[model samples]
Target: MPIPSTLIGIPASPGRAGGRVVRVAEPPGEPATGPAPADPAGEAARIEPAVELVSTRLTARAATVSGDAREVLEATVTMVGDPALLQNAQELVTERGRPAARAVWEAANGFAATLSSMGGYMAERARDISDVRDRIVAELLGLPAPGVADLDAPAVLVATDLAPADTAGLKPGVALALVTEQGGPTSHTAILARSLGIPAVVGCAGASTLTDGSAVIVDGATGEVGEVATLDEAVEAAAAAAVVTDWDGVGRTADGHVVPLLANVGDGPGAAKGAADGAEGVGLFRTELAFLSAAEEPSESRQREAYVAVLSAFAGKPVTARTLDAGADKPLPFLSLDGEPNPALGVRGLRIARDGSGGDGAGVLDRQLAGLAAAAKETGAELKVMAPMVATAEEARWFVERCRTHGIGRAGVMIEVPAAVLTADEIMREVDFVSVGTNDLAQYLFAADRQSGPLAALNDPWQPALLRLIGMLGEASERTGCPVGVCGEAAADPALASVLVGLGVASLSTGPGARAAVGAAIGGLTLAQCRERAAVARAAADPIDARRAVAALDG
Candidate 1:
């Protein structure tokens, strides 16, 4: 059957492009059964070089990028270089005389299966494992690493999903846009595409049917794709969106209501980029990158250095640091939450440090707070620390006390659970501020996995249920005189930023690439106009209707 003329998908990184489709290279297939190797010792020795090759290649790729792209690549390198995985593969070769490639494949798959079964964020890691497995197997088989090949010219890269290494290697001007058959808004493809300033449309099921070298137009803003005939129109629309008005390092509405625009940063370089991009402050300073690679709990001095880099980058500006949001997708070696089939709903986020979970979570939290306080003292930057997964007033109060005990003045909690929204009044009084983590809130509210492509609509930020939850928290903020900010992927959407303002959110935090667009979007609308649009959105029956209703108002 012929492919459709137009394809609809989730709008990931917003822009538009026209190019011929170029699919990613196929991954290595499983090897057929073969006879046992004659020299097990020699076969085991081959695994080291193959592993080293994958690690070295990924390290080189990682060095070429910075910010989120570099972080994701470094993570892949860590997975590939895990000593336990190499040891396990060697055991298979020595004990059962399995071929080196097959042993590596089996060992990697075993780990991937365990991760996939845990569901949610951890499940995404399973895909990373598959990518690593293929690369290692391809090395053993003397084939090129499986991923995007060298493009002779600019084109729209189509794939089921891109591995971090492949996505990291993409250059802004060469890879015009990205279209994927799977992956939600927060996938590696989407994150890297935004960082690289490339337009992208993901979760397009029809992408697999696109013929190679066929010209097509992709609208990353509207999630629309069409045949070559639409190229001229798409090019014009893209040009208009590309001409973004420069932000002047302030966030305010047309009628002069102030809103703080902040950046979500991962590390020192990311923070520096955010500051350079005219970000007023650091909104979501993810403190997990330093811990992800640690074999044991990072010492206070080590953690202080990590925090100091970001603090120094944005000195005197407010930097809200989230403490150790580990478990689920990011399980630490020192702080184990093993044997949980459903880690997402189980002990994740703030639940990890909750009383009586049979782990040293409290110690972890205390030491992290001490390091953050020390960084704050050294840098003289305004530091506001928050805990993720706080669903009750008790958790809020407990976290605040811990922060105060460590000499951290400002403390807050993330409103990611439904209960957090419903009981916002009590929780607000216990903390200095609250930040709505819309990604997790949408996932839990709709009971859909945030990473699932087919369920992307339900997990969309425009969903009325999610909006209403934010509205509820907004009301609580107003009543208690506590500030509420949004620090999720949703906050990056320009139109949504206005709606959030109308909903009484005090600040909007997003990636560096989005700061200008979001600031300009809010600057054009009055508070009253924003409220009217928010009402129009909340009155709709579904996300599609809500988006259309709000767009109609803009027209």
Candidate 2:
């Protein structure tokens, strides 16, 4: 008998899932142009309010979601308010005598097409732009915006591509796999799927050809979609593979080198959830969520209340909290930062705190530190405050001094910049601990944008150059007597996590779902084995060879 057809796509998430395919309906086509208004200015006047309404809706959605999904929706909101898009559309309506709907359609599609044509990560953003277009056009047409809701049963979602909004509402475990016709690995669909730990395949041209209700197998790690096994078998295999879940407690290698397993969380609720799932402590507690959710700077009392919740959840356990990491990608109107040609290299993280805020009388950083102090006093949580984007010993000392003044016992700096790594010993003397943010460090180290799927190879955690930098930080920890931890996506990979511990990463913070698997991987190897693998990885030719070297350790 002939084998079933298979479609290959970019693997967005790792895992296998199988079920009957369920196709979501395509977005509605742009409606025919309505009669041109007698007064073009009056038609143009409708633009702002429509944009405002969509912004509010997007903001509402963002509030309900968290993590990458929230970021995607927020980006869409920004696009909806884009001056260029609005100006071009308004010009179409006023000058060309087109109806509001038609003008919006032309403008949004023009913008989206341009981005999609650019290829790579820019093309991936086309979905978000198109999502905004759909919302605005839907509002003008007096119809509900397109989305996927009301799935009757477990399904493998098959579509051309899922918008950020559509993927946000899906309940975990309900969607077996996400297969998209067009999207790269970093697309909203892929990011959301990874967070959910589900199977997903993106950029599959033939994905839309799959029949609704037809049984199909999806290997998300391999980006393969075909009929190889029944859905029941896949579930059974997953259950079998999850055997290591029973092994819990402090992470240790087979030869008993201690490795602390921690969680990366957004808030207290997330921290508590991680703890319940066997997290030893909170490795990364992002404080920006509170600020991102607020219209203005949250009061010290509000920040204190928020901090207390996170601290209380971890209670006596260590919690490494990052102070407000705003600027550039996350701009606060209250913060006075002039536009820069390269915002990535501009006032971001701790640098934002240095800009001298002109809004509130007390500095934003001061308030944040004060809140951390209050939370520490109230909960007696082992809170360790940290700053992002600290590149020098001077900045490290300043942040550490501030933490100490505020009565927080511990402070650290995220050593993601190249300068930080090169001068890590000097910075280590100023701070209590160091955390390596491999994600950004890799991006900046390689000059490869992580957002771009084409540059994904450069950002791979297994890259020898990245491992070498990590090794440098590890050695610095020994020389300076400051513990170093890895609080990045690299810590989530089982094999990579093992290599990380071998390289002298004292702690590993990963998503709660990954903590157990990482711990288990560590438990399976000895410290010497890990060190050997790390050594081999660093000596490897490249990322592919580095990963191969690490994989050989498993054998």
- For every model shown, the clashing-pair count is 0, 1
TM-score of each: 0.93, 0.80
In the range 1-555, model 2's lDDT, one tens digit per residue, is 111438866656656667778887677677677688798998888877888898998888788876556667777888888999999989988999888878988999998887655433345567788888877887887776666656889888998878887787676689888888866554566657766677787777688778877777776644577854566754555444343344557788887788889888877667777878778888888998888757778999999999998888888889999988767556566676665656667678888766654344237888999998899889978889899989999999988888878888899999889999999899999999999888779879988666655566576677789899999999999998999999987787667888898898999998765676678778987899889989999899986567656656556
Candidate number of the best lDDT: 1
Residue 33 local lDDT, model 1: 43
Go through the candidates in order and give each one's C-alpha lDDT. 0.85, 0.78
Candidate 1, poorest ten consecutive residues by summed lDDT:
229-238
Candidate 2 backbone overlaps, count:
1
TM-score of 2: 0.80
Which candidate ranks first by TM-score, i.e. highest? 1
List candidate 1 stretches off by more than 4 Å. 1-5, 35-45, 119-121, 230-237, 240-243, 336-338
TM-score of candidate 1 relative to the true fold: 0.93
What C-alpha lDDT, on a 0 to 100 scale, does residue 549 get in candidate 2?
67
Q: Measured by C-alpha RMSD in angstroms, how accurate is candidate 2?
A: 5.1
